[model samples]
Target: MASSDTKDISYEDLKALLGKSENLFLVDVRSKEEVDKGQIQGSVHIPVDTVEAAFAMAPEQFKAKYGVTKPLLEAPELVFHCQMGKRGAAATTKACELGYVNARNYTGGYKEWSEKGGK
Candidate 1:
């Protein structure tokens, strides 16, 4: 991870990003248990603990592990979220340190997403 002050994006910004780009990755860093309840439709699961490992894997291995194609070393934009902002923020920092310069945290996370009827 780079620093505690990694960038954060609002839910509105996230929605706009979703509309504007296909070169995006929405990573849900909550545990599998939490994700099993429900998740934003297109997001992928990569718990915080494994985020570093995910980026470290070989390209083929990474794809096999996370299912995205070209965002192995340098992602267009990788957005992370959990129940709230903290863990996602931490993971966002980690992603950036791992060379994903475009990584960002969904500050409101799933809680706000749910509150806003995003599901």
Candidate 2:
């Protein structure tokens, strides 16, 4: 599991991941309805609610639905986001507790992303 105060990336670094195809996993921990408003171009949506419900319910379903091919990575750097970072931080904490070695919370979140003119 990752440390609670582990290193975290800036929004610019987050954008660079998408552009450079870094081995980072961007997880949008927002709901479907909120996602309908807007989202990062290639984020994988895994609602905080769903995670709270059960992290092990149909891993294949999440992968297939999200089109991610990576194996269940316990060590990948997972960047989590929500509307304003609150939920994302919770999800990040949970991810770390569940053995994700590198879990991050984007505090700026979608709201800040949009404020910065990101689509």
> Which predicted model would earn the best lDDT?
1
Collision pairs in model 2: none
Candidate 1 wrong stretches, greater than 4 Å: 1-4, 70-72
Predicted candidate 1 versus true structure: per-residue lDDT over 12-64, tens digit per residue: 98888878888778999999998998898789899989988887788898777
Taking all chains together, each candidate's TM-score versus the true structure is 0.90, 0.81
lDDT at position 34, candidate 2:
93
Off by over 4 Å in 2: 52-61
Local accuracy by lDDT, each model? 0.84, 0.75
In angstroms, the error of model 2 at 52 is: 4.8
Clashes per model (N, Cα, C within 3 A): 0, 0
lDDT of 2 by residue, 77-106 (tens): 578899888888888778667766677888
Which ten contiguous residues of candidate 1 have the minimum total lDDT? 68-77
